[model samples]
Target: MVTIKDIAREADVSPSTVSRVLSNKKDFFNPATAAKVRKIAKKLGYRKNTLAANLVKKKNNIIVVVISSVETNFSDQIIKGIQSEAQGIGYDIMYMYTHTTNEEEHKHILETLISRQISGILFVSVILEKENITLLDAAKIPYIFVSIKPDNEHMVIGSDDQEIGYLATKYLINLGHKIIGLAGVDAYPYAGFSRIKGYQRALDEFGIEANEKYIFYGDYSYNSGSQAIKYYHENFSSLTGIVAASDSCATGILNYAYDHKIKIPEEYSIITIDGTNLCNITRPRLTSVTQNFRKMGSLGVRKLIKLMEGKVNTKNKSIFVPVKIDVRSSTARLTR
Candidate 1:
């Protein structure tokens, strides 16, 4: 609770002299005088106001991690990566969830962080409006988008989802899965649509007809995956392979087939994206295209730091984390 005035009054010096001594601004005060001020300040149990100091210095070592929601495993992994990297650099991180739609809440959070002198922001799977982006620009607060790229041009860190899709399809193709079905996403964020595009491209490249009926649209959930499989069973009865938008979707398909007495890898070969830990616990471990969530999270924080430090300009930067397929027990060469 002790202010510079209190320290100065007790030390019998000007507030400016006390400030200089506390800030370690040498050559402005005699060594003995500075020492005496420090000794008195220590005796008074003085604690420095970090917020005020940061306001005066025009910088802070705090980074705000703004997420739309934390319901997914991907979000947890990304946060871990962000925390690890931030701690290594002697920076502190604070979490703020916007829930993706609450504009007023998001604005209030931004204002609070700005007032508290936050140095940078890391948006995880959250999109910003043009007005919000403009506001951050005007306030001179550096921000980096993580997980998914925003519509506006800004610094972003995410996976090459289209490439991930293509790779998943290609893997199925290499295993001779000619009638490969797609359990697609029916929501926004380019990951779903891009992966569908990659699936179609892989089919086209392999000289196989990409059947529209085989592509079932669903949200990224276990029920959606189950529904897709049900649709596949009812319509594309001959479909022997499937590429899902997420691990949960793939798990859905696996669960449905198990309950219905259908065999996997023998009757159906399945693969999914976002190869999180869900791949391991399935009856037959799922074959998955793994996204480097940790690496993406770490790289995103690093990019944000660089932007905050003025080491990188905010001129449409993009960091694409790569993806790879992990062949497991669920997918096999289609003998049919």
Candidate 2:
């Protein structure tokens, strides 16, 4: 292996000088000496051992990003944000996937990260249970959450889910639909619960009774949407509007409606959250609440960096990005 000693000898400099140059210790050497050392190191094909080097420095530039095994369009956009921000600050990302909500996989991944002494971790839509959090705390590995936040106040960032829910539900109400139903997925507690509350709040604002019978919960799979719609049809046939938890779920309902020959808009109006590309491609096209997931990811990395750097706020801090509704063909005025 090409070593610093070889470069030092070839460049007619001491090993210490070569070391300083290779490590980019700016104050340790003159410009000419640094330039000479770099030139000779290149010529001699000397490769610095990153692992050994980091061992001495007690630091690494790698950050681990934990994501769920079931990938979503929102997940992809958040990843792009993370990549852009991490690269901007001289850090690299290593993706780790959790096969399910099982905490064992999470524990194993956390242990691996701790063993490797990775610089930091960015959790994308995965919430760490108390045990895992305790482990991370003991290991002193700073992490930031994106797309989801735990009960504790910590460095986390996400979109304003309640606002999206309110806006969509209110839109339906404005179109003269009173018997509106909510089609929600059971996944993502932070997003799902907040949105449900928002839906309730909008109903309360308009002096409408909050009925549990009108709420349908799904597993976030495509089948969940169709099944929820079927349940709604059988029980609450008077349902005139729906605020779906996700675009994928909305698409499922749209497909079911087409298959069952249920006329949209004339009979029912629908809006979904997470305005991914799937919204535009559906037959009638879906109106959706758009959250800037890319920004959420970028902000999460920045927050983790701040924590890693020992920047402290008086209390734990979280940033919430704003959301907007994208009007589309799937919704219309109540014809009845």
Candidate 3:
């Protein structure tokens, strides 16, 4: 281990002088002495320990944003938000990726954050269950939740899921499709439930019965969407429309219909959420509910910074961004 004593001996200075110079104590050394100390420290390969410095300061300018999964398009946007805010505020960022495998990793991540003295943490769209919350509480660091959520606990900001669901379904309902379906998967986190509720809200508004069979749940993957379509085809006899919670899932639906010889809109219509550029590249440009993730992510960072600075309050201090549906080739009036 390289010690201050070694560097001081090499520099021909007292350990106290070395410490004062390395800590950048302004008045402790004259310019000539400071210059000699700097040269000696450099020659000795001495580097200031950021962790030790942060410990003495009792807080860190470093903020770590941890996400459970990084595969989603929207999660990327949340990251963009964090990076933007950190850059603007001049805070260092340590990005942590924790794949959803176990409860222990979440605990480990939290403990590691405290051990390193991370000032704040931003959780983007991945729910931290009770055990994980207990871990965070033990860490005692301020945290802000972004995108994915469970009812009121930490500071959260994301697009309004209820309105998003209502809008997509309402769009289909307005297009005169009577047999609209809400596509979901239990493993997809909160998107499934929220989108289904949105679909139900639209159905209730139209005085239609909330058919349980029309609600299909599968994994929220493109392949899952393909499987979901097959399930719907076999079960829902007269399904004319489907609203997928994810654009990736919707892309799956598009491929399934094309491959299985089912007509889209002429036979069925589908809409998805999170209008990433990928939607435009698909065979039939997908109609989707668009939320600007870059903006969302940037705003999350701003909010987190405010919270860290005591400029923002936690209770009743959430930001709900609006969402818009992008109409494209995949959706059409229920023909045939």
Candidate models: Cα lDDT each: 0.82, 0.82, 0.78
When 1 and 2 are scored with TM-score, the better candidate is: 2
For candidate 1, write residues 145-191 as lDDT tens digits: 88775563676788877788789889989998888888846455556
lDDT for 270 (candidate 1): 91
Error of 1 at 167 (Å): 0.7
Residue-pair clashes, model 1: 0
Q: What TM-score does each of the candidates earn?
A: 0.80, 0.86, 0.84
Query: RMSD of candidate 1 to the true fold?
Result: 3.8
Candidate 2 lDDT for residue 274: 91
Residue pairs that clash (backbone atoms under 3 angstroms), model 3: 81-297, 81-298, 125-148, 185-218, 265-268
lDDT of 1: 0.82
Q: Which run of 10 residues does model 3 get worst, by summed lDDT?
A: 184-193
Q: List the residue pairs that clash in candidate 2.
A: none
Residue 88 lDDT (model 1): 70
Candidate 3 per-residue C-alpha lDDT over 1-336 given as tens digits, one digit per residue, 9 for 90 to 100? 567898778778899998998878988778888888888778877877777777899878888877766345557766766676667675788888885435677778877788877778887766677877877768767787777675565667887777788898899888888888877545454656776777789999999888988777765568767877888888877888888868778878889989999877677788888888768998788898898777777887777777778887866666788888889988898655
